[model samples]
Target: MNFRAEIDIMPLKELLDPQGKAVSSGLKKMNFTSVEDVRIGKHISIKLSANTKEEATTQVENACKKLLANPIMEGYKFELIAE
Candidate 1:
């Protein structure tokens, strides 16, 4: 079976997001006053082959924990779709 994993990595909510803040400030300066806050994150897409959905889930989770996301400063979530 083939699976597509869609992952999102984001800074922990307790941490400050300077990039997001900067963008938000820029938007407000551009007259987008309605914007209150902004947070930036990464979206990752991975396609892989696995024998079962559980295997695919494990692979994606391991990828996130080991390489894709910084567990100390960032958190991640992913969804798997059959392909």
Candidate 2:
């Protein structure tokens, strides 16, 4: 079976996101005052062969924990689809 994983990694709410905050501030200066509390994150897509959706999810989760996301300051979520 072939599977695809769509992953999103974001900074933990307790941690400050400098890039997002900067963007929000810039937007306000540009007259986009309604924009507030902005945060930035990363998206990752992976395609691989797996025996089942559960297996694929576990694989992707391990990848995220081991390499993709920093556990100390980040959180991650993912979805799996058949492809």
Candidate 3:
């Protein structure tokens, strides 16, 4: 069996996102005043072979904890779908 994994990585709440702030400012300058509190993040996708959704989820979680995210300064979430 195979699974499709979708991963999202974002900065911790306490971390200051200069780039995001800068972009937000730019948007306001462009007359997009409705936009507020902009933040940026990364998305990653992967395909894995597993016997069950539980196994695939575990694999993706482990990958996030070990290499995909900097647990101290960043947060990550993932979804697993059987393929």
Best by lDDT: 1
Lowest summed lDDT over 10 consecutive residues: which window, candidate 1? 57-66
lDDT (Cα, 0-100) at 71 in candidate 3: 90
lDDT of 2 by residue, 35-76 (tens): 868999999999988998888988998999999999999999
Clashing pairs in 3: none
Quote each prediction's TM-score: 0.96, 0.93, 0.94
Q: Write one digit per residue (lDDT tens) for candidate 3, span 1-83.
A: 99999998999989999889999999999999999898888899999999888888888999999999999889998888777
* Candidate 2 ranges with C-alpha deviation above 4 Å: none
Best to worst by lDDT, what's the order? 1, 2, 3
Error of 2 at 40 (Å): 0.5
Report model 3's TM-score to 2 decimal places: 0.94
Error of 2 at 55 (Å): 0.5
**Residues forming the 10-long window of minimal summed lDDT in candidate 3:** 74-83
Better of 1 and 3 by lDDT: 1
Model 2's number of clashes is: 0
Between prediction 1 and prediction 2, which has the larger lDDT? Answer: 1
